[model samples]
Target: MIDLQQDDGLWTVTLNNPGKANALTGSMLEELLRIAEAAQEARALILTGAGRVFSAGADIEEARAGLTTSDLWERLSGTIADLPCLTVAALNGTLAGGANGMVLACDLRIAVPAAKIFYPVMKLGFLPQPSDPKRMAALIGPARTKLILMAGQKITAVEAYEFGLVDRVVDPENLLPTARDLVADRLVADPIVASGIARLCQ
Candidate 1:
C-alpha cells in the first residue's frame, strides 16, 4: 500500500504495507510510479515508509512471479530522477533489494540510525534494474557499490552515510522532519530558478 499526502507544493509518499516490511508488490510499484509521475508539478517530494523497514524490496510471491526483472522498477526510478523538483528519500528503517533504485534516484537521502541498506541482486540471481547500479555508483562510488551489489554486504546507516549513500543519519522521530527541512529552501524559492539549479548540479 502507498499513501500520498500533499501540502501546497510539497508531496510526501509513504509505503504503508508494514506487515510485510512494506514489501512491494507489482501493484504497489505501479502506484508508486504513478505518484512519482504526478509529482512533476511538486516543488518538493519526500519518499518514506510507514514502519521499521523502508522496504524489503519486492514481495516474495511477486518476486517469484517475475517482479524482480520487471521494467516498472526502472520506470519508477527514472521518473523520480527526472522530476524537476527536490526529491528526498526519508528512509525510516532498513532498505533492501530493488527498493534501492528509487532511493538512489532521489536528490537526497536521509535515513534513521537503525536503518541498514543492502541489495542482494547477486545472491538473488538477478541483475539490478538498469539504472540502479549507475545511480548507486554515482552516490557511493564504484567500489563501494560493488561491495553491496556484488559481495552482498549489508551496511548500517552510519556506514551508508560515510560511503555517501545516505546524506544524513537521523533519529527515527526526526527523519521526515529533516527531509522536509532539507527541501524548505526549494519550496519557497522561485520554482524556475530552483529547478534550473537542480539541473545544473546534475
Candidate 2:
C-alpha cells in the first residue's frame, strides 16, 4: 500500500504494509505510477516507507500468482524520470529487489544510516529492466554497477553513499527532515528553472 500527503507544494509518498516490508503489489505499483504521473502540482516529491523499510521490492506472492500483469519498471521509470519536479527518495530503511528501479529514477536520494541497498533480480529469475542498469550506472558508474549486479551484492548505507547511490546518509529519525530541507532548497529556485534542470539532467 501507499500513502500520499501533500503540504506546501511538497508531496510525500510513503510505502505502507510493513508486515511484508512494503513489498509492492501490482495495484500498489499502479497507484504509485499514477501518483508519479500526477505530481506536477508539487514543487518536490519524497518517496519513503512506513516502519523499517523503504521497500523489499515487488510482492513475491503476487509474482508467483502470475499477477504481475504490468511492466512496473517502464511505468515507474518513465513517470518518475519525466516528472516536472524534483524527486527524492528518503531511503528510510533497506531497499531490495525491483524497488531499486524506483530509487534509480529519483533525482536525489537520502538514506538512513542503517539502510541497505541491493538488487536481487537475477536471484528472482529476472533481469534488471533496461532503465535499471542505465540509471544505476549513471549514478554509481559502470564499474561499480557491474560489480553490484554481477556479484548480487548488498551494500550498506555507507557503501551506497560512497558509491554515489545515495547523496546523503542520516539517522532514520532525520531522514524526513533532511529530505524536506533538500526540497525546501530546491523550492527556492524558480519553478521553471527547477523543472528545466530536472528535465535536462534526467
Candidate 3:
C-alpha cells in the first residue's frame, strides 16, 4: 500500500503494509505513479517505507499472475527520475530486488546507518530490469555495479555512502529530518531553475 502525506511542499510517499515488508503490488505502483504525477508542482518528494524493509520489490503473486510487473516498475522508476523537483528516498531498512531501481532513480538517498542495500536477482536466476544495471553503473561506478549485479554483493549503508550509492547515512530516527534538509538544501535554486539544471544533468 502507498500512504501519502504532505507537509509544506514536500510530499512524503510511504510504502506501507508492514506484513509484506512493503512489497510492491500492481495497484500500489499504479497509485505511486498517479501521486508522483500529481505532485510535480511540489518542492520535493520523499519516498520511504513503514517497516523494516524498504520494499521486497514487485509482489511475488503479481509476478506469478503474469501482470506487467516490470513495466509498472519501470513507470515508477521513470516517474521518480523525471520529477521536476528534488526527489529523495529514505531507506528506513533494507532494499532488495527491483526496489533498488527507485533508490537509484532518486536525486538523493538517505539510508539508516545499518540498512543493507541488496540486489539478489542473480541468485534467483533473474537479471535485473534492463535499465537498472545501467543506472547503478552511472551512479556508483561500473566496477561496483558489476560487484553488485554480477557478484550479488549485499551493501551496507556505510559502504553505499562510500561507493556513492547513497548520499547520506543517518540514524533511523533522523531519516525524515535529514530528508527534509536535503530537500531544503536543493531549494537554494528556484524550482524552475533547479528543474532546468536537473534536466541537463539527466
Candidate 4:
C-alpha cells in the first residue's frame, strides 16, 4: 500500500504495508510511478514507510504467484531519476531486497539512525539487474557495490552513511523534518538550474 501527502509542494509518500514489512506490490509500484509522472510541479518528493520497516522489497507471496516486477522496477527508478524536482528517500526503517534499488534511485537518501539496508539477491539465487548494480556502484563505488551484491552484506544506517549510501542519518523523530529542511534549501536554487544540474548526474 502507498499513501501520499502533499503540502507546500512537498509530497511525502508513506509505504503502509507494515503487516508485511511494507513489501512492494505491483500496484504499489504503479502508484509510485504515477506520482513520479505527476510531480513536475512539485518542489520535492519524500518517500518513507508507515511502520517498522521501510520496505521488505518485492512481495514474496506475489512472486510465488507468478508476479514479475522487473520492468516496473526499472520504470519507477528511471522516472524518479528523471524527475525535475529533487527526490529524497526518507528511509525511516529497515529496507531490503528490491527496496535497495528504490532508494538508490533517489537524488538524496536520508535515514533514521536505526534503519538498515541490504540486498539479498545472492542468497535468493538471483542476480541483480544490470541497472541496479550500476546505480549502486555510482553511489558508493564499485568495490562496496560488489560487497553488497556479491557478499550480500547487510548495511546498518551508520555504515550506509559512512560509505555514501546515505547522505544523512538523523534521529527517528527528525527524519521527515530533516528531509523537509534539506528540500527547502534545495528549493532556493533556481528550478531550471537545479534541473540542469540533476540532468548532468543522469
Candidate 5:
C-alpha cells in the first residue's frame, strides 16, 4: 500500500501497510516505482512510513513468490536516485531487508530515535539490488556497509548517525517536521539551481 500526498511542489510518499510492517509486495513496489518516476516534477519528495517500522522489506509471501529478485526494486531506487529534486527518506522506524535500497538512494535520511537499520541479505540468501551496496557505501563507507550486509549487525539510530548512515536522529513526533525542514530551502530556491547542486554532489 502506498499513499502519495502532493502540495504545491512537495510530495510525500508513505508506506501504508503497517499491519505487515509495510512489507512490500510486487504490486506495491510497482506503485512506488510509478510514483517515483512521476515525482520528477516535485521540488522535494519525502519517503516515509505510516507506522513504527519503515519497512520489513519484501512481504514474506511475496518474497517466497520471487518478489525479492524482482527488477522493480532496482527501478524504484534508481528513479529516486536520479530524481532532479531533493529526496529524503523520513524513516519513521526500523529499516530492514530490501527496503534499504530506496532509503539508500535518497538525497538525505532522517530517522526517529527508535529506528534500527539492518540489511540481512546474506542470511536471506539473496544478493541486494545492484545499486544498494554502492549507494550504501557512499553514505556510510564500504566497511560499515559490510558490517550490515556481511556481518548482519543491526545498527541503532544513534549509531547510524555516527556512521553517517542517517543524517539526523530525532524524536518520533518531530520526524516529518524535521524532514520538511530539511527540504525547506530547496522548496523555495530556484529549481534549476537546487537540482544542479544535487546533481553535482552525485
Candidate 6:
C-alpha cells in the first residue's frame, strides 16, 4: 500500500508492504496514481519504500489474477509523469521490472549505496510498458538504457550514478533525510519557476 505524509511543503510517499518486497498490486498502483494526482499542493514529493527494499516491481501473483497490465501502466505512469510538484525517488534497495518506470518518471533520484537496479521484462516474455524505455532513455541516455533493457543487467548505486540514472548515492540510513533536505531546499525557491525549469529540462 501507499502512505502519504506531509511536513511543511514536502510530501513523502512511501510504499509499505515489505513482507512482499513491496511488490505493486493493481489496487496499490491505483492508490499510488490517486496520491500523485491529488498531491497538487505539495511543493515536492519524495518516494521511498519500507524495510530493506524499495520495490520488487509488479506483483506476479496479482498479475495472474486478471489485472489489465496495459491499463495499470497507463494510469500509474501518466500520474507520475504529470505530477504537479517535483518528484524524487529514494531507492533504498534493489529495484527491478516495472518499478523502473516509477523511478524514471521522477524529476530526480537518490539511491542508497547498496541499491541495485535491473530491468528484465524481456526475460519474462513481456516488453516494458510504453513509458519504460522512453523515460529511461531520457534520464540516462539511449546507449545505457539499451544496455539495461537488452542485457537485464543489475547495476549498483555507484554505477547507476555514473551512468546518469540517479542524481546521487548516499548511505542507506541517510536516504530519507537526504531526500527530505533536498526537497526542503527546493521549497525555498519559487514553485512556479522551479516547475518551469523542471518542465524545460524534461
Q: Give the winner by TM-score.
A: 1
Ten contiguous residues minimizing lDDT sum, candidate 1: 191-200
Better of 2 and 4 by lDDT: 2
Q: How much does candidate 5 score in TM-score?
A: 0.98
Give the least accurate 10-residue stretch of model 6, judged by summed lDDT: 66-75
Give the clashing residue pairs of candidate 2, or none.
none
* Model 5 agreement with the true structure over 39-135: per-residue lDDT tens digits: 9899999999999999999999989999999999999999998998899999999999999999999989999999999999999899999999999
Global lDDT of each model? Answer: 0.94, 0.86, 0.85, 0.85, 0.94, 0.84
Clashes of 2: 0
Of models 5 and 6, which has the larger TM-score? 5
User: What would the per-residue lDDT of candidate 4 be over residues 1-202, giving only the tens digit for each residue?
Assistant: 7899998788888999999999988889889889888988787999889887899988998766644446788888888877788889999899988877768888899998889888888888776655789888988899998888888888999999999999999998999899998899666778888877877876
Q: Model 5 segments beyond 4 Å from truth?
A: none
Q: What is the lDDT of residue 157 in candidate 1?
A: 94
| Model 4 residue 160 distance off true place after TM-score fit, in angstroms | 0.7
Off by over 4 Å in 4: 200-202
Candidate 3 residue lDDT tens string, 1-202: 7899987787999999889988878889889889977977788889999988898777788867754345877777888887887999999998988888877888888899878988877787776777788889998889999898888899999999999999889998899999988888565667778877888886
* Prediction 3 TM-score vs. true: 0.92
Candidate 5 C-alpha error for residue 144, in Å: 0.9
lDDT of 6 by residue, 68-114 (tens): 36577666777877876878999988887788887888888999887
lDDT: the better of candidates 2 and 6: 2
In each prediction, how many residue pairs overlap at the backbone (N, C-alpha, C within less than 3 A)? 0, 0, 0, 0, 0, 0
Q: What is the C-alpha lDDT profile of model 2 across 1-202, one tens digit per residue? A: 7899998889999999999999999889889998998897778999999999889877888878754435876788778987777899999899987888888988899998889988876666777777889999988899898777878889999999999999999988899999999989776779878867766764
